[model samples]
Target: MKIATYNVNGVNARLPVLLRWLELAQPDVVCLQELKARDERFPEQAFHDLGYDAVWNGQKSWNGVAILSRVGEIHETRRGLPADPDRTQSRYIEAAVQGVLIACLYLPNGNPRPGPRFEYKLRWFERLEAHLGTLVSLDAPVVIAGDFNVMPTDIDVYVPDRWRDDALFAPEVRAAYARLLKQGWIDALRELHPGQHIYTFWKYWRRSFERDAGLRIDHLLLNPLAARRLKAAEVDRRPRGWDKTSDHAPVWIELSDKPVRARTRKDASSHR
Candidate 1:
């Protein structure tokens, strides 16, 4: 099955672009972030018309998250982190779809470091890390996907030197991200394409996309059971080039019906 994550930026403004991409991608499941709308404004009927059943947690004009699936009924498991620093933000939502626990999140963009906002970001990350630790050892497949808003490594951003002072690439944030991986979740894209320069987001200014100047902040982290089923991971950059589209493109992973053999070559697997 194909599972994808996208930061829509603004659900209402990007509705056209989003619809076009969804039609073309036809993923089995999708996790969306940055809806920038209230719960009542979510366009639930639009998704319903496309055969996608969804559950969303939306904020009026800022953060939000949602899970959409056509493969199975979306059984909501959680809506926010156990210890969310700011309860007001609609940044997280989780659900079970097609037998997989999917966590969709829109981490805070703590810009302008050395400030309270940055502190909030770290606090939020701490809460998320603590909560995810509980799921790492689950027997079932678990997917943690979202716009993490951090460049975990230098390679994830276009210019390491230029972003050193940026909250998304700061040493502390990167360290926090590292600690998250130590909890036994695999960074699907990086794991599959080691050393390759892959990006999921680009700025509207400076012709970032045209210049291929981007960041890989959107991610899909998989638990052990889910990692074993990972067949492929990729970034669909087509949508980023669309008119008035979101800065982020879609990142996706293909999972098999059954776990791949222990010694099987990643590219050669044929899971049941």
Candidate 2:
């Protein structure tokens, strides 16, 4: 199965670009972030017409997340982390699609570091860490995918020196991201193409996309079961170059038909 994550930036404004990319990529499942639309404003019928069933949590003009599956019914599991009931941003949404648990998230941008926004970002990451810890412990085939809004390592950014003071590349933010990986989830792109300069997001200014000056903030993280089934992962940079496209491109992973299972002695003999 092919699964993808895209931060559309503004769903409505970028609908055409998004539709064109969807046609070309044709992923079985997709996690979308930054819808920038309200629940009622979401173009459900548009996706339905594209033969995809979607479950989304949308805010008026800010954070939002959605899961779209072309194969199975998307059964929603949750909206946001239980750690913060007062958190009203529509940044998270989880669903079960094609027997896999998918968590779509749009983490806080946390710009202008050493401020309250940065603090909120850390707090949000803590909640995510707690929630992901519970999910990974279950050892289910889970994929937590979307725009994490942080450059976990210097390798993830194009010009590390320029972004030293940026929240996305800050030491504390990177530490939080490391804590998440310690929970046993595999960063799909990095795991697949280690030591390669792969990126999923580019800025609109300064000809960032033209120059391929980008960052790998958008991610598809897999739990143990899903990681075992991982066949390939990539950043679809073509869409990022399209007309009026999102600053972020799509990142995807392909998995085998079935989840990997431990081989028993009898099973091993049968294979042999």
Candidate 3:
């Protein structure tokens, strides 16, 4: 099965680019962020015409998330984080596609460091960490994919010094990402091509894409069960160069269809 994630920036504005990429990439499952539309305006029919079933959480003129499946029905498991009762933003959406538990998130871009937005970003990371703790224990196949909005390491950005004071490259933000990795989730892209400076996002300013000045803020992380079956991971950069495309490209991973066997009491006893 092939799963992909893209931060579309704005679904309505980038609909044409998104449609074209869907045709070219042909991913079995897709996680989309930054819909920037209200719930009623999601354009679900368009995706359905392309043979995809979608579940999305929408917010007006801002954050949103969605999951699309071509070969299987997408059963929504959760709409937002467990403690998020108010549902202030449409940043997270979870669903089961095929046999994998998929999580799609658009983490806040904490700009203007040492401020309210930055503080909120850190708090958000805390919630994500708490939520992921439960997921890791499940030991079932899971993929947490989205635009993380953090430059995980110095190598993840075009220039470490340039973004030193930026919230995305802040030390605390990188540390939070490291904590997530410690939970046994494999960074699929880094694992597939280590030591390579691969980027999934490029700003429109200063001809960032033209100069290849980009950041690897988008990510696809696989839990242990899914990691074992990871065949390949890549950033489809062609779409980033297309007309009216999102600043972020699509990142995807291919996994084997064979499901991870559930651990039985008998197997547990044998190991003792």
Candidate 4:
């Protein structure tokens, strides 16, 4: 099963690029962020025509999230994080697709440190930590995919010193991200290519993509149940180079149909 995440930046403006990628990638499930459109403005039909059923939480001219599934009907679980600092923003949406829980989020960028936006970002992280705490230990597999908006570690940034004062690379923000991983969620990309300088986002300025100056702010995290089935994780960078494309590329992961069973007299075998 292939699951992918992409921050389209502006769904309507990038509809063509998005549709093109969807056709090419053909992911079984997709989590999209930064729709930048209202619920009524979401081009649901565009996705349906591609054999995808989508559920989106949208807000006007700002953050929004959606989950698209082609493998099965999407059973929406929730639309927002519990106790979200600002429920007005459409940042989170969860659904069950093919027996797996998929969480799509577009975390706050929290630019301009030492300000209310930054404070709000931290508060949002607290709520996420509180809510995800209930999910990490679940017996059912869970996949959290989105633009986390934080450079988790120095390696996740193009240059640690260059972004030292940036909100995305703030020490507090990075610490919060680390805390999330401590909950037993595997960083899918890092798990598969720990030493590689992999990046999913790049600035349009200064020919960032052309120079390979980018950041790994986008991520797909898996719970232990799902981690055991992880087969591949990748970032399709071609789309990022396209004209009128989003700064972010799509990140995806392939999972085995079922978890590999443990060695035991009654269950010493792979499930798929």
State each model's CA lDDT, in order.
0.90, 0.88, 0.89, 0.90
Residue 54's lDDT within candidate 3 is: 95
Per-residue lDDT of candidate 1, residues 1-272 (tens digit): 89999999999999999888989999989999999999999999998888899999999999999999999999999999996646789999999987899999998889889899899899999999999988877768899999999898888999889999999998989999998887777899987999999999999999999999999999999887888898999999999998999999999999999987253343222121
Encode model 2's per-residue lDDT on 100-126: one tens digit a residue: 899999999998888998989989999
RMSD of 1: 3.6
Greater-TM-score candidate between 1 and 2: 1
TM-score, model 2 to reference = 0.94
Candidate 3 matches the true fold with a TM-score of 0.94
Give RMSD to native, each candidate: 3.6, 4.1, 3.5, 3.7
1 or 4, greater by TM-score: 1
TM-score for each of the candidates: 0.95, 0.94, 0.94, 0.95
- Mark the regions of model 3 whose C-alpha exceeds 4 Å error after superposition: 259-272
- Model 2 vs truth, CA RMSD: 4.1
Better structure of 3 and 4 per TM-score: 4
Candidate 1 TM-score, true structure as reference? 0.95
